[model samples]
Target: MNAYLILDLSINNFESFREYIEKIPLFIKKHGGRYIVQGVEPEVMEGDWCPERVVILEFPSKENAKEFLGDTEAQPLFSIRHKSTTSKLILAEGCS
Candidate 1:
């Protein structure tokens, strides 16, 4: 089964976040993950949920998603993301 990592982000510091944007793809590819949806502002079809920017990534499995999220070498990049944006993230497994 595949897994997805979905992010809702409000970027406060674009300059810093840009660094994360530039660098994260390498890690994602390394972990067998690919972007399903990159940076996009979603159109709300339901009650009161408007995200500034949304990202969705797909991985081969839950383990791949977990490894991407927990990479030690990516800690600095994660910090950059954390400091530059108010973000929410979730991992969901696709139905088999």
Candidate 2:
């Protein structure tokens, strides 16, 4: 089954964050993951979860998702994110 990494991020430093954001797509591609959604304008029809930003990434499988997240080449970009935003992330398996 496919897996997804869903992120709800609140950015604090826009300029610094931009640099890191730019690097993510290539990293995902390198790991054979695809972007299902990235920072689309949110619609607040009704909910307490007014997430500032949302990203959903689809990977071939849960193992692929874990490997992508644990990649050493991608580790440094985290500091840029850490310095720029607070984020909530979850990994879940897709229904087969």
Candidate 3:
């Protein structure tokens, strides 16, 4: 099955987060991942949950998602993201 990485982020440091975002395209390319959604505006018609930003990345499989997350080359950029935002991330298999 295909896999997806979903992120809901609330940014505290916009400038630093911008830097992190700038670096992500190249990082994703290196890791064999592609952006399905990046910083997309979400419509919550009736919900208590209001997310600041949402991102979804599609990978070939769960193992690929894990490898991308665990890549040493990606760690510094990921650390910047960690420091700049509060985020919830999940790796899930996509339905056929």
Candidate 4:
């Protein structure tokens, strides 16, 4: 089964986030992950759920997604993200 990382973020510091963005792609690619959606304005059909930014990443499997999240190479960049934005991130497995 495939896996996805879904992110809803509100950026506090664009400059710091830019640095994180610049460094994340290589790690994503290395871990068999690709962006499905990035920083797009979302349509809210129902309740009061609106986000400043949304990111969706697809990985080969749940394990791969976990590996990407835990990657040592991405640690510093991950820290940057924490400082740059307030985010809610979730990992979900796709139906096989």
For model 4, the local distance difference test gives 0.94
Superposition-based RMSD of candidate 4 using all C-alpha atoms, in angstroms: 0.7
* lDDT by residue (tens digit), candidate 4, 1-96: 999999999999998899988889999999999999988878888999998789999999999999999999899999999999999999999999
Alpha carbon lDDT of each predicted model = 0.96, 0.88, 0.89, 0.94
Lowest-lDDT window of 10 residues in candidate 2? 39-48
lDDT at 35, model 4? 98
lDDT per residue, candidate 3, 2-87, as tens digits? Answer: 89999999999999988888887886777678999988878887969888789999988888889889989889999999999999
C-alpha RMSD values across all candidates: 0.6, 1.2, 1.3, 0.7
Give all TM-scores, in the order shown.
Answer: 0.98, 0.91, 0.91, 0.97
* lDDT (Cα, 0-100) at 49 in candidate 1: 81
lDDT of 2 by residue, 1-96 (tens): 999999888999999999888897888888789999987757778978888889899998999889888888888887788878999889999999
The 10-residue segment of model 1 with minimum total lDDT is 41-50
lDDT, residue 1, candidate 3: 77
The worst-scoring run of ten residues by lDDT in candidate 4 lies at 38-47
lDDT winner between candidates 2 and 3 = 3
lDDT of candidate 4 at residue 5, scale 0 to 100: 100
* TM-score between candidate 4 and the true structure: 0.97
